[model samples]
Target: MKKSRILLSTALIMVLSASSVYAHPGRTDSNGGHTCRTNCTERWGLEYGEYHYHNGGSSSSNSSSTSKSSNSSSSVKKSGQSAKEIATQKAKKAQQEKEAAVKKAKQIKQAEKDGYADGLKDGYNGISNIGISKYQGAYNKGYKEGFAKGKLKLTNEKNKAYRAGYSAAQNGKSSVVPSIYQTNKALSDSYLQGFERFVIDVEKQKYYQMGYNDSFNMEKYIKPDFDNANHIRWYKEGFDAGKKKQAA
Candidate 1:
């Protein structure tokens, strides 16, 4: 009975050693796995060319699952980075737009100020409101108002000059502008205009009276030595009227 037990134990050891050799027949790969080559279906119950892991190594399916999980995590991380980049770009763009708006506002304000100043000066100088075409918006409005004011002021000054010249001429003074108006071309021209009108009126009256007296005395009609055509025309008309009245 003792010999039979020892023999049984030896047989058990041989069986275990043969099973260990058969289970790991070929060399393992980096993943502790290799393809089945010899006795694939009979020894290991695996198909030919099938890959399997050994010694607690992970299976290809498990590696695939882990790889998929890792890729998913990497993809999530990349997605988060992309989102952050987009937000940063949007913030930078908003700041740029705000700066541009402020710059535009300053330019507009400066333009408005320059336009008003130019308009005021041009209006006061009596220059034409050409700023209407040269400038826009508030400038044109200011130019028109200034032009009206300047024209009114010029008109008042001309009226005063005309009155002074008319009084001088009626008093038999020389047709000359006063010293005060000589410095101003507009006023000087207006004064000369008034003085000439009064002188012409007096000359015209004298010619009419002379023509009337000659017609009453039945003298021959003769043209006067007047340089003015209007004066000669007035004399002829008066002579004709006097002849008509005498005949009536």
Candidate 2:
């Protein structure tokens, strides 16, 4: 009987220890929670010393809250990244546009410069046709200004050539256009016109003076060379006028 009683006592102690192992017996804190210390994995499926609730608290609710927080954080991060990407794109586009504008401006400047040079050359040479250009407006503006300047220069040069020809004729020099004006038809024509005017004036004055002197002295009429029809006509006209003056 004594041995059976001792055996029953041992069995009762074993049952109590087993129940304690599974029961998680501990004084509850203010939040009805405590750290797992016994059979943590087997009884609660948790790590040792991990905090958990046991007063009908739902772990799924806590898990859902944590998941929602993580999702919110992820969304914020994604939004920040998206905004940064947009800003980067905007900056890149702006830079490209700025570069393109600068390139266009440079092209316009170059076109104007080329047009001015071409227009100056053409105008100076008396050319009338203006060719095509990529930047037509800028090129046309430059061309107009250049053409005006070139035309003025040509006019001044032509006038200078005329004066030179007139002086040469007045000094009885050869009626030859200068080598400088030989290549330009306009200047050559101007020089020739001046030379002819001076020669005609001198011939008329000489014929008129000779007729007057002869008539006043009562000399016989001296005729001019008939090789030039103009000389003959001028001499005859002068002789008639001088005769009338003497009679009056």
Q: Give the alpha-carbon lDDT of every model.
A: 0.71, 0.75
- Candidate 1, 107-219: lDDT as tens digits: 66655565556655555445665444333655555555556666677778888898888788999899867799987688898898888878888888888877777788876
Candidate 1 ranges beyond 4 A from true positions:
1-126, 132-135, 219-221, 225-228, 244-248
Candidate 2 local lDDT, 10-67, one digit each (tens):
9999988755543576665765456667777777666666665553333455766545
Each candidate's clash count: 0, 0
Tell me how many residue pairs clash in candidate 1. Answer: 0
Q: Compute the lDDT of residue 203 as modeled in candidate 2.
A: 92
Winning model by lDDT: 2
- Superposed by TM-score, candidate 1 places the C-alpha of residue 228 at a distance from the truth, in angstroms, of 4.2
Q: TM per model?
A: 0.47, 0.55
Deviating ranges (above 4 Å) for candidate 2? 1-81, 208-248
